[model samples]
Target: MSAPFDLARQRFLTRCTVVSLPKPSPGAPPPSVVYYMHRDCRVQDNWAMVRASQLAREHSVPLKVFYPLFPSFGNMSSRQYSFQLAGLAAVEAELRELRVAFHLDHSSPPAAAVPAFAAAHGAIAVVTDHLPLRLLRSTNAAVAAELDALPGPVPLIQVDAANVVPVWEASGKREVGARTLRPKIGKLYGRFLTQFPPVPKMPAGSPLPPPTDWSAARAALKVAQVPDAPGLTAGTAAGMAHFRGFCETRLKKYAAVRNDPNEDAQSGMSPWVRFGQVGFQRLALDARKLGKHGEGVAAFIEEGVVRRELSDNFCFYNEEYDNLKGAAGWARESLELHNKDKREYTYTLAQFEKGETHDDLWNAAQLQLVGEGRMHGFMRMYWAKKILEWTESAEQALEWGLLLNDKYAMDGSCPNGYVGVAWSVMGTHDMGWKERDVFGKIRFMNYAGCKRKFQIEPFVSRYPPAAENCRKAGGEVALAPGVKAGKKKQKKA
Candidate 1:
C-alpha cells in the first residue's frame, strides 16, 4: 500500500483510509482528481473535499465533484429529496465559485457509477466521504474494486468527514455502549477536534459549466409524496445559522431540559448533520467556546461527538445493524425469550404509519413525526419502545421502527437513526432492565413514564389526532404547531 498523502497536519491523515492505491502510469497525466460527494455534501469544512483538492493541486489537475443521485434511496420521499437537492444546488454553486466542475450522475449502485465517472473524466484518483452503514460500506468496497480495475488503477480514498475521530480509528470493534466509546473518543479529541483549513481557491485549469437545473433534478426522483418539512430550511448557510441560533438560545437549557419533550432545548441540527450540510466538528468547535454554558457545552459534546460517533461505531462494525441480529447476545436472548409474550395491544404497520393507536401520547408522537418530519429525541425512545410493546416480535418491531424512522424523519436512513431505533426496541447499547411480560429484560417505556418526564397532555394537544381521520369526520383538522388554521373564506357572491 502507498504511504498516506503529504497533506498538512499529518494527524489528519488518520481520518482517511486508503482503500486502494493507483498504479504508476506510463501515459499522459490525468486531467482531474474526482471527489465523489456523498455523505458529506457541504463545500466547506469538509475533509474529503479538502483532501481531494489538495491531491488535485499535487498532481497539477483540476478537481471535479461527481455526485450520484439515486432515484430513491433510504425509503426517502419528496421531503428528504427536496432538502437534499436544495443542499446539492448550493454545493454546485459553491464549487462553481472555486472553479471545480460539479457533475450529477443519475445512477444506481454508486460503486459502478463513481468509477465510471472518474474514468470518463480522466481522473488520477478518487476521494469520497466515509459512512459506516452496511450499504455505504459495501458500495465503497465495490467502488474500490472498480477503481483498481481501471487502466491507471486510480486510487480510491475515503475520509471520515462525518465523525470527528474517524470511526475505524476510534475503535476496531463495535462498542458496547457510549460509555465504552466515550473514553476512546475523549482521548483522541485533542488531536482530531481542531479547526478545518479552508478549501482554498483551486488553480484555474478548466472553465466551469452552467449551474445545475435543480428543478429537473427533482423531477428525476421517483420518491414518495411526503411534503417538505414546514419550518426547517436546507443548505449549509441555513444549517450554520440554525446551529448559531441553538448556541445563542436553546443551548443554555440543553443540559437541563434536552430530554423534556415540552422544551425546545435540544440542538435541532440533526437534519443538517445527517445531510452533511455542515460538519459536526464545526458545531463542536463553536460550542466549546461558549464557556458561559459550561454544563450545556459538555452535554452537547457528549451527545454530538460521543453518542453520535458511538452510533457510527455500532453501525460500522455490525452488519445486521438494522435488525435484531445486531443486538447483543444478552439483548437478543432476552428478546427471544419474550418474543411470544402476549402483547396487550398489537398494531399493524399500517396503523403505526398512520398514527392510529390507542395511546394518545404515542399517537401524538407519531403524528409529530409524520407531520413535522421529526420527533423529539426523548419521544423517539418512547415511540420506538411502544412498537416493541405492541408488535408481534422484536424483529418486527425493529423492522417497523426502522421503516417509519427512515421514511418520515429527514435524518432517517443514517447510522444514528438505525442505532436509535435499535437502542429503543432491542436494547442495543443498553443493559437489560427488570424482566417484563413483552419487554423481557429490554427496557420498557409507558404513558405514565412519559407523563413523569413532560406534560404529555399539552404535547398531545400540540399534535391533535391524525389529519385524515379528522377530515373523514368532516371536521376542520388542527394544524401543526406554528401553522394556524386560517379562517375559512365566506362563500363568494
Candidate 2:
C-alpha cells in the first residue's frame, strides 16, 4: 500500500471519496479497517469517516474508529483531557448508531495501538485525518511506515477535513498575511462550501463494540496537574447549537464588534472547530447564505477559514513554527537590533501565569483565558505581544506564551495558537510596524491601545486583583498576581 491518495480531487460533491490504494491479492477477505487519529472527530459531516465508510462498503470490510489516549504528552492538560473524552464519548455514541465499532487505546501511541487493533481486527486499509501538529503528524507517518514494514500491505489514507478550502488547495507557499490569502480563499470558497451529507447508514454488524465508558475514560487521564475549570462542555451537538446561534444572531454585526471583548461579539466557536466537533465547510456554507449579513459573514469566514487554515499551512510546512527562528526576516532583524533596550518591567513565566504584570488590561486578558479556557481574539494579540515586550528574550516570550496558552486555553495546542503567538511575539503573519522597546519593528500592543478601544473597568472588575496573603501562599490560591504581592491589600484594608 502507498501513501494515502489525495481525496480533494473529488471536491465536495460527496461527503466521501474512494482512495485507490494498492489492493491485496484476489480471494483474500476484505480488510478490517480503522482511521488512526485527527480533527474530524465527529461522525456527522466528517469526510474522514465518510471516506472510511465508503472504503468499507466498497471492499465489504468492517470499519471502526480508533482514537489513542496517551496521558504523557506535554500539552495534554486535565481540561483538554476532559474535553476530548467528552467529545469522544459523543463520537462513540454516533458511531454506534451507524453500527460501526469504536476502540479506545489508552496505553500506547497510535502507531502501536492503531496497527495492533487493525491487525487484530484483520484491517487491510487504515484511513486517518490529517493534522498539522508535529507529534500527531509524526505519529501518523510512523503508523504508515510501520504498516508498510509488515508482511502484507495495510494502506493508510489521510483525509483533509479540518479546513474549508483544503490546505493544499489554499496555496502552495506560505501566505504573507490575510490580505494575500483572502482573495485566494474567496476564489475557492464556492467549490468547497457545501452542506454535509447525512451520515449514511450501514447494515448492522453483529452487536457492535460496547460504547466507551466516559466515566472510566475521564478517570484514566493522568496527564498534567491543572484542575479542571467548570462549565466547559464538549460535543458536536453543543458545537452545532453554538454555530447556529452565532449564524442567526451574531453574524449580522460580527464585522462591527468582533474585536470588542465585552460584546462577546465573536463566535466562540474556535474550541469546537479546534476539536473538529463542527465542520469548517459547514460554517463556510452557512456564512455564504446569510444575505443580509453577507459582509459580516464574509469577515468571519475570512478568519474562520482563510486565516485559520493558513495557520495549519504554516505549521504543516514549517517545523520551527513555535519558535522565533521561524519569524520573518524583518522581524528577526528588528528584534535583534533592540535586544538591549531599556525595559520598564520584567516578569517571569510564573508572574505572567498569575497575571501579575502591572497592566490591568493584560491581567484581564490572562484572566479570561485562565478562568474560562478562552480569550477574545483581539485580546490574545495584546496579551502575547506584551509578553515579548516584558520578557527577557523573544524566544522566552514565545516559550512562555505557548506554554501558558496550551496549558490554560481550550483552543490552545493548535496551528492558530502557534501562528498567533508567533505573530504577536515575532510578527510571522504580519508586517513591520512602528519601532518600540523589546519588540522593535515588530507589531506593538499597549495597555493604552486596549484602553482606547474597549471599556476596561468591567473587565478589570471581573477578575479582581489577587490579595497579598493569597499571592504569598504560592499554591492554587496564589495563582493571581496582586494577591501574592500584597498589591490589593492596601485597597481592601
Worst 10 residues of 1 by lDDT: 8-17
**lDDT at residue 31 of model 2 (Cα atoms):** 60
For candidate 2, write residues 168-260 as lDDT tens digits: 788877788788878887888766666665656677664577667667666777767676666667898998888888888887789998888
Q: Which candidate leads the pack in TM-score?
A: 1
lDDT of 2: 0.74
Q: What C-alpha lDDT, on a 0 to 100 scale, does residue 20 get in candidate 1?
A: 36
Per-residue error (Å), model 2, residue 427: 0.3
- Candidate 2 regions exceeding 4 Å error are 1-6, 9-30, 466-493
- Please identify model 1 stretches exceeding 4 Å from their true place: 1-30, 107-109, 466-493
Clashing pairs in 2: 32-123, 466-482, 466-483, 467-483, 468-483, 468-486, 471-483, 471-484
lDDT of 2 at 203: 71
